[model samples]
Target: MTEQLLSIHELTKSIGSIMPVKGISFELKRGGCTALLGPNGAGKTTTLRMLAGLIPPTRGEIRYGSGDGHTDSWRHRIGYLPQYPKFYSWMSGMEYLSFSAKLSGLSGKEALRRSREVIEMVGLQQAAKRRISGYSGGMKQRLGIAQALVHEPELIMLDEPVSALDPIGRREVMDLLDRLRGEVTVLFSTHVLHDAEEICDDMILMVDGEIAEKGALSELRTKYRQPVLSIDVEPGEREVAWLDSLANRPYVQEIELGKRGAKLMVTDMGVARAALIQELADAEIQLLRFEAGTSTLEDMFMKVVGS
Candidate 1:
């Protein structure tokens, strides 16, 4: 029970000429849920696997707890679920959890008891007896979580846990993770910024296999926060051209264009707003929608990655 559950220092993973994770470093707090935020191929999975002892890093160290930073003797304290968790299609959920429990060093009786308990904790009790082949995608993900938790590890690391699931399935897993927060120090990787913002107080943002930003969610939000204007016009050549011209406006800092709309990052919201409205009126462009708001967490994510 140290306050720091884990600390990664100058962690580097190199493969020949390609470096998947380059000198990344961060710390995870005890009993805190942290999101490894990044897009595809950002080395998120690699980082998680390395931390989970699936692979050794090319350079750097991972210190578990406040101990002497020993690498060995820390596996039992961790639980991991990969993005695509594999399981025997014929095995029932209960069987899989029990097997995993035993693999984690629990005795037969302990394994069974833990399996039953975790099955109920993840809301898989109803489907615990059913074959894996018959369970839905969401149920299977829950079972994967159950297996991970069966050993009652101190920290759980999940790699892109919800990326493969449908909306409903994703919500189910997210909700479960939210509930598990504070109970177990959770570290989950996800490219979806909104998901991280929703449940995690801390985040490690990655881009191109390197750390882009890492901090408490509130701090990062304020650090990247800015005035934003989202505008949508009817899909027509004239309207599209009008939107394109706004990119060169003096007050606009950046612009992300979409099919029917564009989100503009502005230095001065009031000036840009009045000018943009005048330009639209003068051109008689068909305005479909308009909004004034601050940069969202997703916007900040894109900006950091892009930077």
Candidate 2:
């Protein structure tokens, strides 16, 4: 078993009078990507900030590597990138990265080297010397990621990194994050379910200041209904009638027929699937093709939150 890098016990946070995070607790593994997903005002950012030590929890305890038998300090291994990173407009991209490195305790020569490395890592080397004021939104975001990783932190928190990016820019940043998969532990918050589904190994869905569900993607999928199987056979009246009859089955939630064969909303495939295949075989129906379909992450989000 791998060691835990960060642990929270009954962690809670409140703002003056209102509770924003209510007794949330979970463990983050030493090297894994865990995405925090929620709708707007779901306390995703607040939780990330609290865990990053930017804002202390109002109650409960957070320990880093206390029982892991490690010697290095945890703070030096944690990096945080907020939704919007502030940089000096007068400074060049290279200068900004170098400044960030210095603040993270890098020496002058080390800062310069790390700065160059990160600038290139974010694919900003060509524009490294360009003033930040002239940079585009995507460019700024890449620079933000560079600064966050400048300290060589083992655990990084990215709060809505792709929220402000366009499709292309989002893909770029997501690809960069994908490259860091095994090397670091990432706890990123995002409302984009597709992004989370694409990049996360595990996820925690938060709603109303609490965790609605947490687990590996496959585990969650299995816990819920098996994926809906959408089949489009060759168009024919016999096929349509056959599919329509299947709608009466308890496992088949809904069925629709058109120029395509049929679309089924099946709740369980473990038993219904074998029965379906057998039914088709018995009827001597020529099966064009069949596949298992799945509800999107958005569907899962709504289901989990009961919204």
Candidate 3:
């Protein structure tokens, strides 16, 4: 079994009348990448803030290391980057990283050494001497990641790290994160399911301040996998009537219809596929496209969040 790096139990946070996190519990394995996934207003940021020690939880326990005991000393073993990080515009990337390293408790010389090392690790060495104000959005985010790594913490927590980047910027950060896997324990939050799917091994899905689903990504995919069929036909009286009749079919569990097509949730793919093709052939329907497949993580995400 893998070693456990962090364990949270019944962690709750309340701000007067609003409770952003409600008794959430999960564990992170050492050297594993986990995604705290949820839609907006789902308490992902609040949970991360509490774990980062930026705010006090109203109740529950946070434990680090292999021991059952809890302590505040784990702060030094972890680094955090918020969703929206602010930097000193006048400072160069190297200057900013060195300053941050010193603040994290390294000597001046060591700070400079680590700063240069991390800047290079993040692929910002070319722009290390450039003022932060002139850096593009992707560059700034990479710099932010560099600061988080300057102290060489065993674990790093990033809140919505790529949520605001353009396609190119998002790709850059995602690639950087992919490279960081196994080098350090990572826990990042994001609402974009594809981003989470692209990199994370484990997932803790939050909904309205509660964990709607939590498990290994592959396991969740297996547990929630369902048969689905997509059918598109040239719009006409016959096609429209045949499409409308599908919802009542015993093999179809559910359906979503469009002007030219219908997406079907089926009980069995083989039966549904054979039956649909035959129906189209018999009806002489003008079929444009037909596809059969299993549901994906996005399907489960929508089911959990929509509920």
lDDT of 3 at 158: 96
lDDT of 1 by residue, 64-152 (tens): 98886565688888999988999998999999899899889999999999999999999988888889999878888888888788889
What is the model-wide C-alpha lDDT for candidate 3?
A: 0.93
Which one wins by lDDT: 2 or 3? 3
Candidate 2 lDDT tens digits, 1-307:
8888888778889998888899988888888899998888888988888777778788887778647432234556788889888889899999999999999899999999999988988899999999999988778888998998898998889999999988888878898889878888888999867778898888888888898888887677666644677776666777767766777888887675556576667878777678888888898666787777766656567766667
Per-candidate local distance difference test = 0.90, 0.82, 0.93
The alpha-carbon root-mean-square deviation between model 3 and the true structure, to one decimal in Å, is 2.8
Stretches off by above 4 angstroms in model 1 are 229-264, 267-292, 304-307
Residue 292's lDDT in candidate 3: 92
How many clashes in each structure?
0, 0, 0
Off by over 4 Å in 3: 69-71, 231-250, 257-262, 274-291
User: How high is each candidate's TM-score?
Assistant: 0.83, 0.77, 0.87
- Model 2 residue runs over 4 Å out of place are 66-73, 227-297
Q: Give the per-residue lDDT digits (tens) of candidate 3, residues 1-307.
A: 9999999999999999999999999999999999999999999999999998999999999999788645467777889999999999999999999999999999999999999899999999999999999998888999999999999998999999999999989999999999999999999999988888999999999999999999999999888788999999998999999999999999999898999999999999999999889999999999999999888888878877877
Candidate 2: clashing residue pairs, number: 0
- Per-residue error at 174 for model 2, in Å? 0.7
Candidates by TM-score, descending order? 3, 1, 2
